[model samples]
Target chain A: MPSLDKTVAEPMIVFDGVEKRFGDNVVLSELSFTVAPGEHVCLIGPSGSGKTTILRLLMTLEKCDGGTISVAGQSLSHMTHNGRRVPADEKHVRDVRKRIGMVFQQFNLFPNMTVRGNLIEAPTRVLGMSKDEANARATELLDLVGLGDRIDSHPTQLSGGQQQRVAIARALAMRPDVLLLDEVTSALDPELVAGVLKLLRDIGSSTDITFLCVTHEMGFARDFSDRVMMFDGGRVIEDAAPEKLFTAPEHERTQAFLHAVVDR
Target chain B: MDNLGTFLSVLSQGLPFTIIATVGGILLTIVLSFVAGLALLSSSKTVRVISRIYVEGLRGTSEVVQLFWIFFALPVLVGFQIVPIWAGILVLGLNHGAYGAEIVRGAVQSVPRAQVEGAIALNLTPGQRMRRVVLPQAVVEMMPPFNNLFIQLLKSTSLLSFVSINEITRQAQQVLVPRFNPQAFEIFLLLLVMYLILSLVITAIMRTLERVAAARVGRRPSARSRRQATGAGVA
Candidate 1:
C-alpha cells in the first residue's frame, strides 16, 4: 500500500474555477477540486450532471470554457510563455496528456486490432518502446487483467465484460499516473458487471496510480472509494468519506439522489 | 454474317487500348482521391479550400465537356498537345477522382467518435492516429463505394472514342459508317456485352478485396453476407 503521508505531499490533479458550457447549456460551473496521488475518488450523480465531463477534461478530450486545469503541478489548460500563462498549444496539451489514461464507458477498443495489437500500439508508436519490450509489457498487462490466454482475440470477439477488461489493460499499458474511469461498468451486462468491478478493485488496491472515476454503482463506490463526491446541477453538492456520506449525508439533494438510485 | 466478322475484328483491335485507359485511369483516380480527401481534412484553410474547389469544379461539370476542354483548349494555352489517349486518361482520372474524394471523406468521418477519442487518450499523434487506427477502419467502408466509382470510370472510357482515340466504341462506329448495310444495332450490342463483361470482372475483384478487408477487421460472417448482398446489388 502507498503511504498516505507521501501521497498528500503534492496533488495529482487540480481543477481551479473550471467552467464548461456547450452552446447554451452549462455542464460544469466553477468546478474546483484536487485529487491527491494514490487516492481513489468517485464522482456519483444523476445523468448529465457533468460527472463524465470532469474525466473528459482531465484527458483533454474536451476543453474548458474558462479556468485552468493542472496535472501533477503543471498547467494542462495553459502554457507558461515568458512568465505569462496563455491557453495551451497542441504540443503543450499533448505533453501534459501523456501522463493520463482514460477508459471510456463504451470500451472503445480499436476494432481493427487484436487484443495484443491494441495493447502494444501506443507504447510502440507514442512512447517509442521497442517492439520486444512492448510485447512483453502487453503480455504482463493481459496477465494482470486475467486475459492472458485471450490476447490474440479481437475486441468484437469478446463479451462486454471481457472487452472492458482489455480496455483497462490497454490504458495501463501507457503507465499513466492518473487513470480516469467514465462509467466503465454502465454498459456491461448486469451479471457481467461484478467481475469487471472486482478487476478494478484489485487494480486500485495494488497500484499507486491515482483513480478518478464516475460510476453509478453505489455499492462498489461505498466499498472502493477513499472519497465520494455527490454532484448535482453541475456542482459538487456533497463531498465526504464514503462511510459518512453514504450513511449520514448532509445535503438534501444527495439524500434525494441516493433515494432515487436505491429505489432503482 | 461478314459484318459480324468485321465487328469482332474491330473490337479485338481496340480492346487493348480500352483496357489500358481504364486501368491507368483507375490507378490515377485512387491516388488523387486519397490526396484530395486528406486535403479536405487538413488544418490549413488554404488546403481545404483548394481541395473543395477541385472536387466541386470537376464533379459539377460534365465529364465529356471536361475531356474536350483538356483535349482541345488546354493544348492552345500550354503551347503543347498531349496524345489523345493520354488526354482521355487525364480527364477520366480527374473527374472520377473528384467524385471518389467524397467517398473517402465520408468513410473517414463515419468512424465513431469514441474510437477517435480512444486513440487520442492514448496520446497518439494526429498522423499516427489516422494512419494506424482511422484509415484501417475507413478502408473497409471505402471498398464498396470505390467499386462503384471504378465501374463508372471504366464506362466513361467509352467517351474517349469521341476525341479520335480508337477504343471499342470508336472501332464499332468505324465498322458501321463505311458499310452499306450500316449494321449499327449488331455492332452496338457487341460493345454492350464487352462493357458488361468488364463490369462483372471488376465486381468479382472488389468483392474478394472486401472480404479480405472484412476478415482483417474481424467483421462477423453474417454482417459480411448482408454487406456482400447489398454490394452485389449496387454493382
Candidate 2:
C-alpha cells in the first residue's frame, strides 16, 4: 500500500457551501467538504440523500444551484483564464473534467465496444494517447483487474463482476487524480460482489489517488475508508473516522441506517 | 410491334423518375429525421414543442395533400413556381422525414439513461457522448424502423404521377390507354416485376447492413453458423 499519510500542501478538491435543488425538492443543501490529496472518503447514505449527486456535481454532470467547486487549485464552476475571474465556459469545464473519472452502479460499458476498446477509448480520444500506447495501458489495466483473458470479450459476454471490473479498468486508463465509485458493486449478484470488492480493496490499498465512493457495504467502508460520512435529508449527519462513525455514530438516522445496512 | 416499342420506351423514360424520387426522398428523410429527433430531446421546452408540432403537422397530412400543397399551393403562397419533378421530390422527402423522425427519436430514447450517465462519468462532453456512445447504439436500433419507412417511401413514389411527374405507373397507363393493347395485363405484370425486383434489392442491402451492425456489437452468430462452427454439434 502506498503512503496515504504523505500529505500535500494543497487540497485536491473543495466544495464550498454547495447547494442543489430540483424544483421543490432539495437534493443537497449547504454541503461543504474538502478532500485533501490522497484522502479516501466514503459517502454512506440512505437512498435519495444526495450521495450520488455529490459525485455528479464533482464530475460537472450536474450543475450546482449555489456555491463554488474547486479542483486542483482551480475554480471548476467558475473560471479565471488569463487572470480574469469569469464564468467558466464549455472548454474550461472539459479541461477540469479530464482529471476526474467515475464508475457507475450499472457497469455501463459501451456495448458497441469490446473490453479492450472500452479501456482504450477515452485515453486515445480525450487524453491524446496514441493507439499503441492506449493499447499497452489497456492491457496493463485489464491484467490488474483480472480480466486479461477476457480482453476481447464484449460487455454482455462477461459476468456482472467482470463487466464492473472492466469499467473500473476503463476509468483507470484515463489516469485520473480523482476516482468516484457510485455503488460499483451494488448491481452485481451477491455471489459476484466479493470479486469486485476485492479488486476495489486492492486498488484502495495500492493507489494514492483520492477516492469518493458511495456504498452500503459497511465492511468495505470500515476496512477501506479513512473517513466515512453518514448522510440523511441531504445533509451530512455524521462524519468521523471509520471506527468512531460506524460503531459510535452521533445521530439517530445514522445509527438506524448503519443497523439496517450492516445486518444484511 | 409498334405498341411494344412504345411501351418499352415510355417505361424506360419513367423508370428514371421513380429511381430519382425514391433515392432522393431517402437521403432527405435521413437528414430531417436526425434533426427532428435531436429537437425532441432538446433541453428547451420551446424547441421540443416546436419539433412536436412540425412532426405532427407533416405526418398527419396525406401524401396527396402534401403533394398538392407543395406543387399547387406552395407556388401560390410563396409566389414561385417549382418544376413538377422537384416538387414531387421535395414533398416526398419532407413527408418521409416526419416518419423517420419518429424512428430516430424512439431509438435514441430507448437507450437507457444509465448509459448516458456512464458516458458523463467518463467526463465526455455532450457532443462526444452523442457521437461516440449514443449515436452508434441508436443507429443500430434505428435500422429496423428505417427499413419499413424506406419501403413505404418506395411505394409512395407512385403518387408522383398524379402531379405529372411521369413515374412508371403513369407511363404504363399512358401506353395502355393509347395503344388499346390486348396485352395490358402483361405490361402491368412487367411493371409489378420491376417494383418487386427493386424492393428486393433494397431489402437485401438492409439485411447486409443489419448483419454488419450485429457483428460489430458481438451478437451471437446464427444457428447455421454455430452449427457449422461446431461441426454439427457432434450429432
For all candidates in order, the CA lDDT equals 0.89, 0.84
Q: Which regions of candidate 2 fall more than 4 Å away from where they truly are? A: A1-7, A81-84, B1-13, B39-57, B60-62, B65-87, B177-197, B219-235
Worst 10 residues of 1 chain A by lDDT: A1-10
- Candidate DockQ scores, in order: 0.84, 0.49
Candidate 1 C-alpha lDDT tens digits along A1-264: 236564467799999999999999999999999988889999998999999999998988888999889888778877889889787898988888998999999999999999999999999998999999999999999998889999999988999999999999999999999999999999999999999999999999999999999999999999999999999889999999999999999999999999999999
What TM-score does chain A reach in every model? 0.96, 0.95
C-alpha RMSD in Å of predicted model 2 compared with the true structure = 6.6
Cα-lDDT of candidate 2 = 0.84
Ten residues in sequence with the least summed lDDT for candidate 2 chain B: B226-235
Q: lDDT by residue for model 2 over B49-107, one digit each (tens)?
A: 99899889998888899998888888998999998887887888899888888889988
Q: For candidate 2, give fnat to 2 decimals.
A: 0.59
lDDT of 2 at B155: 81
Cα TM-score of candidate 1: 0.95
Model 1 alpha-carbon drift over 4 Å, by segment? A1-8, B1-3, B180-182, B220-235
